[model samples]
Target: MAIALTTLVAEAQRYLNADSISDYCPNGLQVEGRPNVQRLVTGVTASQALIDAAIEAEADVILVHHGYFWKGEDPCVTGMKQRRLKALLANDISVLAYHLPLDVHPDVGNNVQLAAQLGITVEGPLNPDNPRTVGLVGSLDEPQSARDFARRVHQVLGREPLLVEGQQMIRRIGWCTGGGQGYIDEAVAAGVDLYLTGEASEQTFHSAQENGISFIAAGHHATERYGVQALGEYLAKRFAIEHIFIDCANPI
Candidate 1:
């Protein structure tokens, strides 16, 4: 049974609350494709390779984490940007993107998903006052060693996490699933024993050591894969729409 593109877009927008957040790409339907979508493809980024793959698969719509037209990005579509859009538009493939909303969505968010894998039960948002904070604070079911936690992160994310273990138990944890090293201060202020994020800057090492908080740098793309997968599963169950997750390998 094929679902109408309009219906899918409407449901996705409502589910993600796309209209409420200030995001890079326009939340829903970046490019219009067939009115009915039988097959949907999802990926981390709407890059040239992903678009080409979607086209080859005859995907009616493509969903991604990083779409076109970010806040500080080069607006002039010249090089890679131009090529990405060209492929999608040429193939008449609809592009739907969710950024912060995808990251912060309680049930299907990146942080929440990553925490779930780490055996942490979420207590609440990292910043309780800030409704838009895309990080979670939680406690491990039982206090595990910092080394054990780091190993678990590696097992789940398929990469050895860059880690700085503080002299503390691994009970209280804070996590942000993408490039969120900037949120170290918030996690520290919240009094969490450990903080985990995707990418680590050089300054993060200093912050982890000086702040006396354990830090783990799981790969950015690796940590993020779960949210969209959960979202795709949700869409499949709710709408009976066929979904496929396309992984474009990104080390960073």
Candidate 2:
């Protein structure tokens, strides 16, 4: 069944409460394409490879977690930007990006989805003071060794997570999906058994070791892959549109 692009974007924005949160990129309709959309493609990032695959799949719209036009990026449309924009304009495929909103949404959210996949029970936010806290603290069904928890992350995420072992056993854990290593401080302050995130900074190891909190740096792409896919499935079910998820893996 075909769905109007406006209706789809509106429903997504409403579900995510996209307008309430400040985001790096525009939440809905980053680039306008055809008015009616039947085939929708979703991905973690709207990179050129994903765009090409969507074009191959004959998608009318491309929805993703990471979209274009960040706070401090080159404003000019040239080089890679030129090629990407040109492809989208020529093909008439819309781009809808939801950054913080997708991460924070209680349902089809990266943190919650990751929790479900990793078998973590939701407890509360990592930073209770912050109203817009995207990071979360939770408990495992049963306590496992630091090594075993890392193994679990690897098994669930399909990639070997970089483990910074600190404590012997892990129960209380804090996590945010992509590039959220900065939140480790909050987790450390909260005295969680371990902290997990997509990317690790240079000082993340030091923080883990010194604070006696184990840490895991799962791949950013791997950690964030679930939200958009879940959103796609929800939209497909809600609107009766054909949804395709294209994975263009990034090692970093």
Candidate 3:
């Protein structure tokens, strides 16, 4: 069976509470396509490769965590942007994307999903005072060495994360998926024994070392792969439509 494009977008926006959340890009439908959608394609980003893959898969809609028209990006659609939009427009494939809404959601958020993958029992947000905080503080069932916890992270993410070991064992943990290294200080203030995020800057190493809190920088793509998939599964099951998650791998 097929679902109307409007219905799918509306349901997704409602499910993720996209309207209330302010974000860099528009949350709900970025591009409109055919009136009805039978097959949905989901991915981490709406790159040209993912768009091509969706086209090959004959998808009626493409859902992603990253979509077009960012806050500071150039408004002109000239080269790469033109090509991507052309392909989607030519094939009648709608593009729906959510950013911060997908990261902070209590159920299918990237942070929550990553915690489930790593066997961490969630305690609360990294910053209690900030209701919009994307990072979360949690605890392992038992204490483990920083190295051992890094091993678990590597195993679950299928990539060797950059680890900055601290003085203590990893009991309390903090994490935010996809380019959340900026929140390291917030995690530190939360008093987590370890902090994990998608990417790290040079100063992040010093923060981990001087503050004596373990830090891990898993790949941005690796850490964020789950939420869109979970959201896709939820939508597919809800609307009784076919859904396929396409992972256009990024080494970084």
Candidate 4:
């Protein structure tokens, strides 16, 4: 049976727990597509390629991490913006986006799921004040060499992580999925032996070497793939609708 756009929007809202704050982009139903959606396509970024793929697949709705109307994006709907939205709007495909909420959701969150897969037991959020903080602090159940731990991360994530080993062993570690190298200081203050994140800044090498904390840069797209995929599967099981994850290979 096909699912109504309204029902799918509500389902995503409940799944992400996004009722508390003013989100930057329209959280659910950014662009109205078909009235009923039999297939829901999920992806990290709603790039033109993804939108075209979804349209070709006859997806009635698109779910993504990065949607339109980001904070710093231009307000004027022109160029690529107009093209992307026009395609979805023209086809009546609903767009549902979950950014930080998906990153922090306990069970299906990117950080939490990545930590669990890497054999790390998460203690709590790295940033206490912000509910949307994407970083988490955790401890490895059994301490291992930094190289061995990195290997395990590679095996679980299917990508070789760029690591800067520090002076200490890796019993405790902090991690944030998706280009969160800024949280290294938070990890250091939390007294974790290592910090793992997607993408690294030029200064990150200095930070790890000087701050006496190990740092690893796992691929951003690689690390963030888990949460949305898990969420998609959950949505499929919970609702009688089609859900497909479209992977856009991103090396950065």
Q: How high is the CA lDDT of each candidate model?
A: 0.86, 0.92, 0.95, 0.84
Measured against the true structure, the TM-scores of the candidates, in listed sequence, are 0.95, 0.98, 0.99, 0.93
Residues 127-232 of candidate 4 have per-residue lDDT tens digits of: 7876655799989878888888889888988889999988678899989999899888878888889999999999999988999988899888888888888888
| lDDT of candidate 3 over 88-174, digit per residue (tens) | 999999999999999998999999999999999999999999886789999999999999999998998899999999989899999
lDDT of candidate 2 over 1-252, digit per residue (tens): 898999999999899998888877778889999999999999999899999999999999999999999998999999999999999999999999999999988889999999999999999889999866679999988999999999988888889999999856999999999999998888888879999999999999999998888999999999999999999999999999999999898987
Q: What's the distance in Å from true for residue 226, model 1?
A: 1.0
Candidate 3 residues lying further than 4 Å off, grouped into runs, are none
lDDT of 1 by residue, 61-124 (tens): 8988777767787779788878877787787888888888889988888778877887789999
Score residue 188 of candidate 3 by CA lDDT.
91
Q: In model 2, state the lDDT of residue 124.
A: 84
lDDT of 3: 0.95
- lDDT (C-alpha) at residue 221 in model 1: 92
Quality of model 2 by C-alpha lDDT:
0.92
Candidate 1, residue 157: Cα displacement in angstroms equals 0.8
Ranking by TM-score: 3, 2, 1, 4
Q: Between which residue pairs do clashes occur in model 4?
A: 33-92, 33-93, 34-92
